[model samples]
Target: MGSLRINKVKYNGDKYYFESPVFTENVILIEGDNGTGKTTFCNLIYYGLGGRVKEFLKEEARTHKEIVNDTNNYVDLYISINTENYHLRRFIGDNDITVSPFTISDVEPPTPNEIETNLVNLDGVELLPVNRSFGNRIFSDWVLEKLNISVIELYQGYSTFKVNFTELFRLIYHDQQPNPELIYKQIDTKSNYISDSELLRKAIFEQLIGKSSSEYYDAIVEAKKAEKEKLLAKHFLDEFEPIIAHLRGAEKVINKPFLMTELEQKEMQLEKLHYSREAFKNNRTANTTIDIALDDSKSIIISDEIGLSESKEKLLSLFDEKSKLFFLKENTAKEITQVIKVIHAHDQLNLFSADTCPYCLTKVERVSGHCVCGAEIDEQQYERFFYTSQEYKEILKSKTKTVSTIELAIKGCEEDITSVNSDIEQLTNNIQNAKKKLRSILDSIDQPIDIETLNNIDDKILSIREQISLLNQKIELENKYEKLSSEYEVKRKAHQSAELIMQGLEVKAKQEIVTKVNDFSDVYNLLMTETLEDCRSARISLDTYLPVINDGEYKEASSGVSIRLMYYLTLLTLSLEDENVPFPHFLLIDTPETAGIELSNLKNCLDKFSNLQSISNDYQVIITTGLSKYPESLANNRVIYLPNKANALLKTKSQSQPL
Candidate 1:
């Protein structure tokens, strides 16, 4: 989240610790008379952060940065964020740095806990994710349920292998912008057109249009309500219908009243009499009146407080062959039979409808929902009866047996009808509830999707994805074709362009670049020299040429525009470079302002490198010089001065150095 500082090692060889003067001004002006180790501090900061400062230096003679590169046994770094401190350190044993940092508390960099990895690597570097989450920023993953990029995109955009939101801040810090001038420099400086165009359009589209993944994704998001509604519909259909059917079928029984007639009650008494007669007759011949009835038609079935035995309800029951019979009320169904000493008080069977026994019948009371068998029937259904059917038959006739059999069949059919009707009611209830659920889902904001519809949509989406995949393949083919075509053009054009430029005065362009490099060197002379006359310039050399090359007897051999070309190409391909590398948007220039006695020549060199760093955006130029050697005409901007000498301190010196 913030910059890290490494061994600003304020100590020299044997010092216990390094102490720094306050960096009060964030715009650091690290000036110390002349030999104040300002460059040494810079070198320490640079090398401490894993930068190769000597590579940028022109001389083979080493600075402390180089010395640190060679013999440094310790490296440290401190990070500042949210006004808090974090530190990292590494020590040299055999070779390598440790993978993960050994973190320290609220302290500045170069902690004392570094360990040596003792591994040597010359080929490449290892990159590892940081141990701590990025917390100083306003963006994080916890804010969203899921996403490809962090919320930082709301302000700056997310990072990539190349440019993104964090990089935007860095650009801001460097005062860089993609203004017209920089764009031109980027385009004009690039030597390769294919690299300029490849992947170029994609970046432009992202900045201008954004989220190539949003087309189908956004569409599905928009349709979420409808999809949820469909799912709700399907759920309702599956759950509610069967329950409703059961309830309806159960309640319908309340509407269908059952009744028995007087004649039926008399028949029930007659059947009992027949049993009693048969039992008595079997014991003696006087039972002739029941088996071979004499004038039996007028016998008038009657009983004086006659009672039915418990087993007499079974019409053909032989177990009660010795039991007496009771003059039961005909309205009393066999199922409602109960124990009684007397069956009647009237010559006419004195009875209301008989009620079934409690435990034997699982009848449930409507009000309290207890079984009617266990509960008293205080309701009106107990006393009421309709004369639906009746019979007054002889006691011993086969017709009684046939009627009993038919009654059994009717009872069985009634039970089956009730069961089937319950099923139908359940199915109907299911259908109704299903409809309700479907309607609810249909009206909901996020409709539940139908399984069938979802599958269909999935198929459609799959088809679209397949089409996009095919399109991607086509794009790949087109890219390969374009690349091959560009290669053909490059090979074809290189020869023609070279031959044309070679024969023409275009070779003079190489001479111009050589002169420019030389002019650049002249600016450096003013710092090392005493007088303008002693500032005679040196010429520049290049190993390669652009558009033309000549090995002219190794004497008048001309160093061509390759240097200029390399510089130009770097500007052009800057977007594609590994962005992790360091670059100061506005360069800190060491110029030969005093020694380039030819003002025109110095002006010319200034014009080129200045134009280079100042391609566009917010680049600046800061030149350091002394009043005695530097020319006044060229110091158009604020010129920093050493003021006096003798205020320098070196942080790290060679272990055995003689300074």
Candidate 2:
């Protein structure tokens, strides 16, 4: 257990000093009247221990301006913690305190001159600032380290704060504040660092009683973070469920294995369609070869038909020439007959003239070889009247020659017509056979192939391939969903494990707290019943750790002073009896008789402090009160006595002179 004890306290000014009686007892009393600076004496000790008593010091300086305004005035406190002796000095109106090891004997109080010499020439003294704004070495750090207490950090709302020595001192020092119902020092509302939260109050109590530790609170914060992460994972899973389900539904509709099979079937069908089209093309190529030959045959037939038409035209021309020759031959034969008749008539006329006149039939005589009618019987006359026999014969011969020429032309024309008819008939027969062969070849080739059917097969193949592509995408989505689900499961298990660990630690800490609280309540009820006049029952609350009187809420009353006083005494008593409690086992209470508390009740409360001392000599309780109110039983515990306002705790000169 840790311990703190005050050995000596001295007040040093420029030309004078006032020193306290040696505090060699566990329970010390400072008895004085109202104006004698008893509260000032108590506050000096508080200030020397790194407490913020500036406000109280201001009030004290106001009341005793002459004594406090001394520029060279300061307080020196000699103390020991855990058996290590030290000296602390604090100047008036200063936030800095000087601390150093004291090797001098504190068995006897130092004289004024010795203290003044020590204050002027102190070595190895460390100056520590009490102001939090300095951000340097603090006075609490030194004191708390000497007391073997670790600074604790607390998390409240969103901000983290530290529980310092000043805050913890609130429970140790019960002040002369008028609020008697207050269980702890009234929270300084003007200070931003202090909070009026019940959470902070409970945390301070838990720290004092050793019910909570930094490690335990750290576990709680970690558990909450894990829980938050787990919920986020769940939210992601819930949001992803619909998208995963939609992809799954699409996969179900398509049926992957079956879709793959159908794709294969469609591909095979497309290949067959391509093969069939190729075969049809090959057949058409063969038919084209046959058609080429037939085209050659038809070309020959067309040539023959042209020759036949030319031959027929030539035959008709020959027939026309033959008809003209026949007409010329008949006309030439008639001209030959007419020329013979002319010649015979001329010979008959010459014979008749020699006998008689042919026309008159009288006997006639030739005169110069002429007829009597003056007809000339000479060849010249015959030439003029009719053709001569030789001439007639020549004419008939020329006519006979013309008739022969015409007969020969008619025969030649008939021969050409006969030859042309034969040629025409042969050409016509050849053209007829060629047409029959062309018709047979046309019937032998197959029909044209359907192009539209190939187009339909291509469209179906493309459609099937698109469906297969969609199925592949769905499969990929499903894989991603599986991975996410696996991660979510891992987070879930981690959250569960963290929650179990936090619960176990909490359960163990609570069990210890309940045991200590029960022990504390027993001491508290005993003190309350003894101190209050009408006290029926009293106990410490399990939840708030406040005093409950007669199964009711603690309210504002004069008796609350006794209740608060006993509550502090119970804490001090528990520190002695309970090993788990971490209370410093020291208290500095000032004037518990305030708030109009009854004199009898105040005496009962004072007796409780004596009772605690009887139970254990390991603790210290320093209390100040009016001299008239001081109980006779605790007279042995009185360490200082100020008779009246004339004999204040501090003087202007030495102890020989009054201010």
Candidate 3:
């Protein structure tokens, strides 16, 4: 990753120019009193590096024309990434900015005329225009590419869902405002990019430390292999076991290759039996006395049977219609009763009003000795009162008409049902008489061999043939089971090896993070000399990245700034030295004096940061705090200090006017 170093910060006002400290060391302190634009200074640094201007600050500036008492002001940041240095300028009220191909020495203070212009461009400048599309794609894309950070996909193919430069800065900057207990709350702001926060954090951590994209990918591969093997094993058992079991009960070798030949021979025998039965029926069946009896019965009653079927269908139709009418009448009666009750209740409630208002529970008084609220002695005079009764009467009349129509339909359905029933009874009697005559004729004559007896014998032969075919299928299934079982065992062993490998990789990553946390804890104790008893067992939470002391979050501590100082310092220090961390190694902490840390403890915190600066020249650490909050230890480290509100961050009107 490329190094980000702020060479200089220049603020241009209409009548004056304000400049920040010149680039000197890795660790710099901006000491000031409250309302000294300490947070504003930090936010400018953040915004210059493409970090989001917090919603609260933007809203404030929107409501109030001037921000931090600066009107029509813009800032210029001279920064260096790795070996290259560039001057980035952004004007107020515009989403566009220009970066010039120049050094910090080349960027002089802007003239009064230049400050009045909108987005003043220098020679050989590159316009970094802001995109209003999803994820601010073009802006973030250019920034991340310049920082030498990879443009990795969080959810592949969804261009908007990717890790952004703003999120990376969240880890590097801690504003003056105290965040929630979560250490990663800096990136908790909602955005179109980074839909899954937890996954994005994990990806960021991996990218920083040079780890693979996902540890679960290997586990997923192993699980899928195991699942396929399981299906193979189950298929053989399900398809073949029942067939084998049935064959074994009949004392057959199902797996025998010759079983199909035996089944074919039985099928041929069954076909011959069917042919024999058909020949027997043709030689002796219709010549019998029962055939003659059946013919006579059919001729006499066939027409009457057809009439009976039609009458039965008509009766069913009439019954279905009657049932629908009956249900309709019942529901209509209930609805009419409900409407009547509602009308009666409404009429009773409107009878007369007491000398009071029901809503307010207050005594009612007539305006100029008359009912001004429209309560009348005669309801006929009230249009609303008269309309309610008229509407109810109309509704009742409509319901009564509906009820009369249903009753008339029901009566017609009943009459039709009676007529159909009479026809059905007469037809049924005629058909029964014809069947009795046929029975009498058959009883008089006898037949020796019947067609039923032949059919029974043929059915038995067919059943035996079917059993033989089933046994052959069982034999084939038994052979398949043996083959798949061996394959399943081989696949199961491979799955087990993959699971062990996945577990080993996870443990290695966890141990590396744990070691970094131990180093952080040591630094924290070095800074906090007057430590609370509860912080004795403080450790950084791997999940939330917050301080966990005695199984509780360190954020809940009485001294808020002290805990915040410890957290930021520990993370910065650990990231600086840890080879696995891909941290940019840049930290901008707004205030470390809030929540009332002792002056001695605050001095120790600054001294600790100063000491860490000697470890490497690769990173920068900037801190802002109140002047009286620190001891003499931070005197040399302080860059700008505000003594009072008059000489605060913003220039007063007296200082800017004609000076």
Better of 1 and 2 by TM-score: 2
Instruction: Enumerate clash totals for all models, in the order shown.
Output: 26, 0, 2
Q: lDDT per residue, candidate 2, 1-659, as tens digits?
A: 56788887777665546778778889989888887878878777887787655543546434446445565566778888877777777766667676666555643434434554432223344657776663465888787677766566566665555667777777888888877888998653335443656777777777677634433555676676676777887887788878867756644444446656665776676577666645543223355568687889889898998898899889889988888888788778777656544433332122333445667655576466564667667745633543333445457668878888888888888888889998988898889888888875665466554547756756665775676566556655555555667767887888788878878877776876787788888888888888786788888787998888989955458988988888888888888887557788889888888889878768868976767655778788899998768677788888788889778887767357432
Q: Judge candidate 2 against the unseen true structure and give its global Cα lDDT, from 0 to 1.
A: 0.71
Candidate ranking under TM-score, highest first, comes to 2, 3, 1
Q: Which structure among the candidates has the greatest TM-score? A: 2
True lDDT of residue 380, candidate 3 = 34
* Model 3 segments more than 4 A misplaced: 15-17, 54-65, 68-72, 104-124, 129-137, 156-160, 178-180, 185-189, 192-196, 201-534, 553-556, 652-659
RMSD of candidate 1 to the truth, in angstroms, is 39.6
- lDDT, candidates in the order shown: 0.31, 0.71, 0.62
Write model 3 residue lDDT over 1-659, tens digit each, in one string: 55677877766544445577676778778877787678767867776665556431445534212443444455668877767777665654445555554532434544334443422223344546554454454556666667666666554332335566666665567665554344453653566555446666655554444333234333534555565676777676667667667656867444455666667777777788777765555323345456766887887699888888888888888899899999999999787766655543333233333444556545566443244475445433533433343356458568978999999999999988888888888888888999898775555454345558777877878787777767556655655666666666766676677667757755765676566556666766654434443455566556745566656643343355566666666666666676445566678888766555667666666666766756677888888888666656556777777766666665643474111
Ranking by lDDT: 2, 3, 1
Q: Write model 1 residue lDDT over 1-659, tens digit each, in one string.
A: 11222212333222222345322221222323445444444444433333334423435374444334543234444433223332322332211221222223323332213212221121221222211135432111211111222222211122112222222221112111223112111221232333244233223222211222122222323234233444455455445445444544553322111212333444455455444433332122233333333233222121101112221233223223212122121223332221111111110122222433334432233443222345655455543431101111112123435446556655665565455456545545554554554443334323232445445545555555554454454444445444555555554555455445433423443344344334333332332122222323322233321111121212111111112222322321231122211222222222223322344433443334333333332223333322333333344432233444322343333222211
After TM-score superposition, the amount by which residue 49's alpha carbon in candidate 3 deviates from its true location, in angstroms, is 1.6
